[model samples]
Target: MVSTIVWGTGNIGRAAIRAVAAHPALKLTAVLVNDPAKAGRDAGELAGLGRRLGVAASTDVEAALAAAPRAVVYAASGDLRPAEALADVVRAIRAGAVVVTPSLYALYDRRGAPPEASEPVLAAIEAGGGSLFASGVDPGWANDVLPLLVSGLATTMDAVRCQEIFDYTTYDQPDVVRYLVGMGQPMDYRPPMLAPTVPSMVWGGQIRLMARALGVELDELRESVARRPLDDTVTTAAMGVFESGTQGAVRFEVLGIVGGLPRIVIEHVTRIHPSCAPDWPQPHSGAGSHRVIVEGRPRIEVTVEATDEDGNRAAGGNATAVGRLVGAIDWLVEARPGLYDALDVPLRPAIGRLGRRGV
Candidate 1:
């Protein structure tokens, strides 16, 4: 069994805990949290599993690493504090633990990743003989794996597009929705996500990944953004009132131009309230989905809708991303130590998980 440590107890961490418990080959060895309030709590309870997992969460990062777990689920939020997140993963890698995370966006495409992000991580892997893979749902599977997988179905292709159609009303991340994404903020309040070149900085790698897989080089990368203000005020159960005229919806794309056209695209249509952008892309029938569209001879379109716990798509998406990460731990344990991208890892199936149950 691969002894694993879950390094965060937030949204992603909650799912990581349950995933580790359910996987036949993974033993839940430790849960590390920076939150003092969460320290010493049972992993299962923190994961909302309705039972104690015996393994308690700890505030001690050093102590957890000292045990030298075979795998580390680095689920800490890297949205704001990316440097610190990279450092944490580096520390874990240098400890000889195979690390998987959704934290490092820059390294999603190792070849296209900036030298600053890729160089240090490579050094860490060389020093410790441990591997690292950075992926999640949007930047994870939907961005690279799902789109590229579907591209194989096309006889001939003109363009490939990946879309995230999500309604964040039920999503509990207010700081992300309000501050980071500028959902309820004024139109002038530009969030870090939509800042010039930031979208390209964040999602441009996925486009390059697809291009590389197709054995073609991108001519250039571009970003386009559009935002809409609410026609009226709205109230959400999770985040309280959002005044009218604030930013309500956003549609943006990171385009990978090949030859002379925008051939590869990653688009997102995110709404704080459904009424804001009636014309923009909506989820198939629910709050969220990852959709792929290939404009080719056959014209293929596929959508992924995932739900977890109480039918929450956001949580479900996170769970699926965790599945991709946790599901690969066993493979990483035996593979040569190095940095890897989604394309380097196979989406292994539930070989022994047919009857698995969480504690």
Candidate 2:
């Protein structure tokens, strides 16, 4: 079995723990947590898996990596601390452990990634002869593999649009929703996510990766953004309350233009309250969806609605992201040491372990 360590115990990290434990070929080793209070806890309990895996959580990064884990699932949040996240990933790579993460947004597509972000990671892999793969749901399977697969059926193509339309009220990440996304901030406040060039910085790689898959070069990359304020105060199960006229919803698109038209587009329509943007598209089910629209000969549209154990759609999305990273572990171990993204790594299908119930 491939020995694995789950680094971080946040949203994606907890999901990674469950995925690692359920995979037949992967064994859950030590879990690394930054919180000292969480140290020495059972991995299963931390992940809400209902049983102990015999591996305990630890605060020592070196000690965990010293155990010679074959792969490290780095699930820590990089939205706010990208440099720190990049450093952590490099440290793991340099320790001779294959690292897969959704933390490093810039390295999602190494070819288009900034030199500063990709260079150090490449250096670390070279130093330790370990591989690295980074990806998540939107920047991952939904845009890269899924669209390419659907485009094959088209006799001719017009444009490709990948959309993540979700209500953030149930997402429950206060820091991300209130501050990073500017969900409950004042109207004049600018969320770091929708800031100038930030959308492109985060999702341009996805557009370029799809362009590569389709064998087309984009003429340019562009971004369009719009924000909506709440009409009245609203409360949610997770995020406490959002007041009237605050930045309640945001809609943005990262477009890859070809021939002066948006040929490849990635869109996000996030809302703190469902009533905020009645005009914008919404998920067909509980909270939200990931949609792929191919405007062409066949005109294909695929909408995905996923739910977690608690029936939260956003948590469900996070789980799939964990699956994408953890699923690539064995493949990364076999692959030559280097940085890999969605294009370099193949899509791993869901074949849950035979004896694992409700995986």
Candidate 3:
């Protein structure tokens, strides 16, 4: 069995641990954490699994690697310190462990990254004879891999568009919500005459991945952002934890160009307040849903409708994203040694079934 080490105890880490523990082909050997408070506690308990797995959380990365794990899944916070987090993954790879992470912005656009960002990591993996892959839920799955999968069913194609629209009313992470939806500010707020860069850091690679997959070299890529506040106070079990009036909304549009001309348009909508639907064909009109439209000789559309148990859209999105990552672990291990994006991997739905349930 392949021995695995899971780093982090957050949402994604917990889910990955649970999944790894139950997989028949893999063994959960260790769990690494930065928090000293969590050290020595059972991994299952930290993940709310209720049972004991005999494996405890520890901050000692070297000790975890000494156990000779076959792979390491780094699911730590990416926003606060991505470079540091990526460095940790690189270290694990150099120690003869395959590394997979969801950290780092612009992972698909390696051209835009500084040589210091990925070169060392790639070199270390090669030196240790290992592999590394970085991907996010929306960009990794829906936009890049999913579109490529759907395109296989078509005879010809013209354009591909993927969209993620979710209500952020139940999202409680202040930094993430603020970064994604442009909260804590007025809708009409503007920079002092200088054009501000929209939050393309979240999904810019999704657009670039699609362009590359279609063999379309983009000449230019542009982003536009729109923000608004809730007209009325909205409360939910998850949102109730946060003070009211702190919620806001944002819309992001990414226009992709081929041969100096616009070709693909990708949009993402994140809102913390209730509002009217936009002028487009949405599956649920107002409720949280994601849709992908492929405009070609044979049109194809796929819609994903997900509702949180507590009706928190942001929580549901996070859960789904974690689930997808858990599902990709096995395939990630089997992939070739190199820096890989989501489109570089084969993402068949059944790959998820290979892992344990919660993973």
Candidate 4:
């Protein structure tokens, strides 16, 4: 079993901890946390897994790396503190930990990522002989290989549209929902996340990744956004009340121009409440769903709804991401030292995972 360390205790972190403990080929060695209160807590308890996994959380970053774990799952929030996250991941890589994470947006498609971002990682990988893969549910394999794999079923293919339909009410990141996404903010408020070129900055890499994978030459990247205000004052189960005039829903797209036409599209329909966006796309049956629509002969639509413990779709989404990244630990440990992207990593099968406690 590959020794593994999980960093962070937030949404993705909790899922990562649960995943590592349950993975047959991965042994949970250490868990690192930023919250002092969480430092001494049992890893399973931190993950709300009901039972303890005999691993405790620690805050001593240096000491954890000193153990030289074979793999690291860096699930800290990079949405607000990207530099710190990057540094932490770099430190792990330098310690020779084959790291997999969803925090780094630029690394999602290293081919289109800026040199400044990739340079340090490359240097660290060279120095430590470790590998790194950055991926997640949406910008990760869902849009990249999942779509490509689905497109294989089509005799002819035209445009490939990837979509994320989510109700943000269950999403635990209130800051991301209210501030960054501009939900519960005034109509005139300009959400930093939706500002000019921001969508491209976040999801443009996914577009480029699909292009490179499919051998499609993208002429340019384009973005469009639409938002709606709550017609009536409403309160979410988690977040406080949103006034009628405040932004309650958002729909946006980051498009890749192929042959002067928008061919590859990454679209998001996010609502603070289910009632906010009546006309927009809805999740298949729950809080969230990722979909791929192939426009061609025998047009096809594939939607994935992952429901984790307690039937929470958001938790399920996080769990799926953890499964994807954590399941890759053994492969990463056996591979050459380098940074890998979505297309490079395979959807590893549950070889010995059947009838397991975690599955």
Q: For each candidate, what TM-score against the reference?
A: 0.98, 0.97, 0.84, 0.98
Residues forming the 10-long window of minimal summed lDDT in candidate 3? 189-198
List the candidate 3 regions with Cα displacement exceeding 4 Å.
109-113, 184-198, 239-247, 259-261, 276-287, 306-316, 332-336, 349-359
| Candidate 1 lDDT (Cα, 0 to 1) | 0.90
> Could you give candidate 3's per-residue lDDT for residues 51-104 as a string of tens digits?
888898999988888776778878787766877887787888888777767776
Candidate 2 clashes between residue pairs 3 or more apart in a chain or in different chains:
none
Candidate 1 is scored at a TM of: 0.98
lDDT score, residue 136, model 1?
58
Which candidate comes out best when scored by TM-score?
1
Over 231-265, each residue of candidate 1 has an lDDT whose tens digit, in order, gives 99999867888899999999999999988999999
User: What residue pairs clash in candidate 4, if any at all?
Assistant: none
What's model 2's TM-score?
0.97
Cα lDDT of all candidates, in order? Answer: 0.90, 0.88, 0.68, 0.88
- Model 2, range 1-359, lDDT digits (tens) per residue? 89999999988888899999888778888899999999999988899888888888999998888888889999888999999999999999998999999888798788988999999988998898888898864537787778888999999999999999999888768998999999989999988999999999988888999998888889999999999999999998888989998998999999999889999999999999999988999888778889999999999999878788689888888887788788888888888899898888877776666567634
* Model 3's TM-score against the true structure: 0.84
Instruction: lDDT for model 4, please.
Output: 0.88
